[model samples]
Target: MAILKHFAVKNADYGAVIDYLKYQHDEFHLVPILDENGNSMLRDEFYFDGLNCNPEAFDLECELLNQQYHKNQRYDEIKCHHYIISHDPMDVADHGLTGEQAQAIGMEYAKANFPGHQALVCTHTDGSNNSGNIHTHIIINSLRKEDIASQLYTERAIDCKAGYKHHLTKEYLRHLQGSLMDICQREGLYQVDLLSPAAEKITQQEYHAQRRGQLNLDMANMEIMAEGIAPMKTKFETNKEKIRNAINDIAERAKSFEEFQRLLKAEYGIQVKDHRGRFSYLPSDRQKFISARKLGSHYDREYLLQLFEENALAAEQNQAQWVQDDPITILFIKSDLRLVVDLQNCIKAQQSRAYAQKVKISNLQQMAKTVAYIQEHGYDTQEKLQDTTDTIQSKMAKARSDAKLTEAKLKRVNEQIHYLGQYLSTKSVYADFLKSTNKKDSRQNHADEIAKYEEALQFLKQHSPDGKLPTMNDLRSEKELLVQQKSAQYETYQYFRDYHRELQTVCENVNHILDISQPKQQEQKRLHQSEHSL
Candidate 1:
């Protein structure tokens, strides 16, 4: 019941598409213009051929389109020779109207919506023996020529240019969609609107897919966009290794799609749908999301296919993949893991700051109690009182200062944690990364680095005397040694990552190879089995 609208222009070479349809469906009568229930200038016609490719049907469609567009414009310079609008044919059959009746409704709708445009409507029906779907096509010519009244018997012919352009623009397309939606509602048909994709995360395929159902497209290949250029190509293997290492980076926290979707929607008015119920994913809400051919009723299949071919070629050149691999998918997994690790670190960092603040506050409170006790009992121990007071005052001043510093540090850390948490909430890359990394364990190599960092922190903390800070020199030397150790592990991680990327690339290619190979292998296995049985 969904309807889609697409616009296209046919050059002189294209002639008319209805004429082609006339030959395809050879059963129905093609009606003429003069006989229809409207006062239109063009000849009304119907299917001389059955439903799809009949001359009469083509002529009838043109006649209807002319009635809406040209009307009484006897001198319209540009005539729309062909326009095609097709829908699920079964909807028409349900109306219990013959093919002619369905064609009539389309013509009527065209006249009502595009008055003053030359309109032609064709209805194609798949018989009960076949699919039983009935669809209508409408072609409209958008230009008309103005006439000048000649004083005499037209001694000279007036040169008239077309007033309207041949093709529809964005505004016009929206108008088309609105009219179609209105028609669908009136006719009690099913309809769905598309969602656009995110701007920050723009990808070419995502952009193209959005346009597929809503616009007339030319074929463009995605390969061209996929091709890795100079710097990226030079370090392709190296960066690939980094990416793999990042992907395999230890996972500290994970959330299911349902949990994430709930959080995203509740926290940030976004809707996610897991196509096939795989996992909640934000659906693209853009014109490009729907393939022009997939746009309910108005999708032009041949035109869209041409667009896809062009897209495929462009994609191939850009990325230059030997086999098809979903790059967004790969990148998404890596990003998701990055977010998870960051989020976990954020929570831990927050706790550490909170603990530091609490310790500072408790220490300040205890120091304040000692000062109060000394002030209250000063007369009883006068001899030692002066020295004790001096010591307590120094300790109290330091405690107060430390407390203020701790509170300030905690406040800053809290702010950072809040901001990072917000960022992690919206970021899907982390979730994807979590899913991918969880699939394989690359934790053993990084484990030592993690242990060493923890050990350095512990050693620094343990060696520092109570209430004393470690010297900058000591901190610097400790950090330098840790960095040196981490660097070695980083190299190992890079090697493993590069090795993993190669494996993944091979695995991705294997899918395509197996698609063909599996059947042949099966065939050979069947032969072997038959031989053994014999």
Candidate 2:
């Protein structure tokens, strides 16, 4: 799925943009990584070209153009528009996309969109996420150099004239996405819907927050695991996710809309308010409420009301077969992918960085290992491969479900042990308070212990239901077994998940090879043509 992203550079040093595009930089520290010789580290693999200017003299040429046009003179003015078109990783893995081809595509796009602008187009093989996605960078000087005929998505007549500044409108961005969709169709590459709102949209801010939070949590977890303790949380949930979980919890349990509101406030401190026929949620931390429209259609007022009605109906019609015990699962974890038939012809010639190019070839060779894996697993046909994938996926699902169940049991055991220990330690104080002739004085002296004893007692009784206190040793034994079981189940789940991913990739590639049905891609192409035609 290729998507268009844009940024405006306020600084006049157009050289920095080209430099960053060609070198390695530390994203975490926001600095350039110098080599042992104290020079900027060159990027591993890239394809670069300039439009209406020399690649080596891009910075000088852009400055001269701006001087000639007397544009982008102010310190705060946007000097250049940086546009990124990131192609799907699957395009490289299956559809044979390469940096050189992507660069050519980006050059064509830049010419078509910003016809009279001096631009630099560069393509790189390695994304920051190491996703192996082919992406192109198109940086156009805000000052145009030559006049051109008016094209599609141009909002104003001045937009096509020389000496005029480049203007990016929302309509132009939509048209860019449409062009990408067309490219994907013509090349038979995978594409995603770029026209409409995603069913679940995470704002750019939330996405970055999640990434940083997950990074911090991972470091914390490493320290925790080094101490030989299993970290309580392996994933970090954002504020929006917390709200979603809170809503889901209350949604499942509450019998009515009124009950739902009460439960949300009581349990999660999330206030759901309705105004002008729309629902908004104000979490405890936020000053302003977030609308359901931002959250998703699932959390909309109409959808939630329908969910509430369905839940009520389900409770009234609860049948014996409505719920069933999960079948037991045995868990385990794979390796392999296929090499492209001809890699040399697609990618740029490996001349400058032999070691880096070798690394890429190594990855290709690693992908070749999949052929041996397929034969070893006796996956002679695509059907066999798909069937095995489905079976492993089922096992993975069962493993995850069982692991969660074990975790719940472990939590209960831990809670029981804590309360029981507290109750035992405070039992003598409470007993003495009861026996004292001046009960008021004794209660005052032992207030803390008495309070602790009663709180523990209440919790134990509620959890027990039958009002029976299980032995400490029994609880301890259960906790020990649960810890081991949880560890095993987690390992099993991870194993099956990796296995499923590897096998699924192979299945998808096979499907691609045989030109199997892809209705979604066809539909996307059809829509692009119908809607984007001038």
Candidate 3:
């Protein structure tokens, strides 16, 4: 599966990005590099276009634009944007797409997405810690090539164009992601959800930290190899994971917001603060507070509150049947919630695999049935078998069409569910902001939080104007129904696909047998005719 990571470079030299993509020396290596990963720091796969000049002279091209249009522009203005398109290592290896092919894909994507921009695309084979992930790097200048007058300009200039500046909004990013997924599907490559559920989302910082920690462990193993000593095993967790675990612990035991805050501070040394409407966590060791949303959906304020409510209700219902547990026991129970979530995910994945297996088995059985039917009905002639094959082909085509329609529907429904989920989860924050009386301080101190809440509220109002938000349960049920519909469509498509292939095979075998028997049948006819004449 492919994932995208991007950032805009402000006041940064384009040459630096080029150099990093082309050169091999790591002057400041943050992670250990394995020897087997090879010394070829840069893969020999790069592509570029739309510069109207040599790519090697891209820096000059950008500079010329700046000179022509914005010579007095601020030094801190964004000059370039760098995007990384990375694929899973196993998927890339299995697909066997060469680095050049990857580069071509990246180039096409960049050219299509960032039209009129000077861009260079490069494919890299060596990932962090020698992970062997194939990824592409696309660097494009931020300056507009066409001339136009806009609010930011008094007159049309060489480097300024109306609506040329890239807007890296959430909606825009989601569109790009969907486009990438479509490209992968067209290319018959494996892909996961680009816009995955919030629960499964992992920030880039957390991902890199986990990778770095793994590399550290790898380095320690290398040392053990050199010393000929027993290897030490130590479990490492990312900071986000640790925070998530801590939050889960507190949410499971506390019944109210105040209790939740008190227990978190007393038991975990973590401070929970509600700024305006958004909730953030500050660890005792850390001075900065991180937003709960950054951790995961489960740790988000609304979800945590929902869990507390559910726990309280369960306790009330089973008070006589339940026994009070100590803090340690409670901790163990809270930890089990994480395990349960993980187990549920595992079950879903297994169910998908089982469905696929069932499809394959059903196809085999149908193939066997087809063969038996052909023998029983004496479909010995090529014409009869050909007619049957054509019928099956028509059915297969219809199934494919149905599957495509179902997939499109599923995509739309899933997207709706995602946004609805986001709005519902952040609705409480928006409500809190509305009820707060210290508007001045709230706006000044909790600017980011307020902005997020307002954004969610705006999106909900725009998309769902009735001011009614679907409950989590309703969304989940809808999601499950859509998933089942998609799965059934997929199964139908696969069944016909496999049946068609098997029928073709059988037709070929039957044709070959008829070819061998034709001469003998002809000779027998001549012999019988001669005997009748005698």
Q: Pick the candidate with the highest TM-score.
A: 2
Q: Which 10 residues in a row give candidate 2 its minimum summed lDDT?
A: 324-333
For 1-534, candidate 2 gives per-residue lDDT tens digits of 887777788999888988888998876544788999999989899988999999879999989888887888899999999888988888887988888788888988888777888899999899865667889999989988998888888889898888898888889888888888888788787888888755455765677788889999999999999999999899998998788888888888777777788768755667888788887998866899999878776776887888899988887666323333211112212443643333344344454466557656764565456556666666788787777788879989999999999999999889999999999999999988888999999888888999999999998998874467766866776677688889999998998888777777776555543442377778888999999895
Model 1, TM vs. native? 0.28
lDDT of 1: 0.41
Q: 1-534 in candidate 3: lDDT tens per residue?
A: 887888788864666666667665442353222346554454344443433446777778777877776642577778888888997787666887767777778977886666666777777777644577788888877766654333221223433452245456666677778878988888877787878646735876667677678778878888988889877565567867777788888888888888788767644567788887678998755789998777777776777788889888887766534334222111211110000012233555467877656655654555555456467545777697787678768877887888788778667556666676666666676667678898777677767766766776566566543465444444455556567767887876677666666557666545444555698999999999999999
Task: For model 1, state the Cα shift of residue 483 in Å.
Answer: 15
Candidates sorted on lDDT, descending: 2, 3, 1
Higher TM-score: candidate 1 or 3? 3
Worst 10 residues of 3 by lDDT: 332-341
Flag the better candidate by lDDT, 1 or 2.
2
lDDT score, candidate 3, position 166: 49
Off by over 4 Å in 1: 13-15, 25-83, 89-98, 127-132, 145-162, 194-534
Candidate 2 Cα outliers beyond 4 Å, as residue runs = 68-70, 244-263, 274-279, 292-534
Give candidate 2's TM-score.
0.55
Question: Please, what are the lDDT tens digits per residue for candidate 1 over residues 1-534?
Answer: 545444444332223454434333222222323325543232123342222223444445444444655542454344453444445555554544456755665776665545444445656665312456556667655443233333222223331223443444455456666666677667665544412211123233433344442232222223434564222122122221222222122111112334334433432223334444222222212222222222221122333234445555676565545223423212322211000112233555467877656655654454444344335434244445444334434544554555455455445434433433443343344344445555334334344444444454454445444434343433343344344444554544454454344333333333333455589999999999999999
Model 2: number of backbone collisions = 2
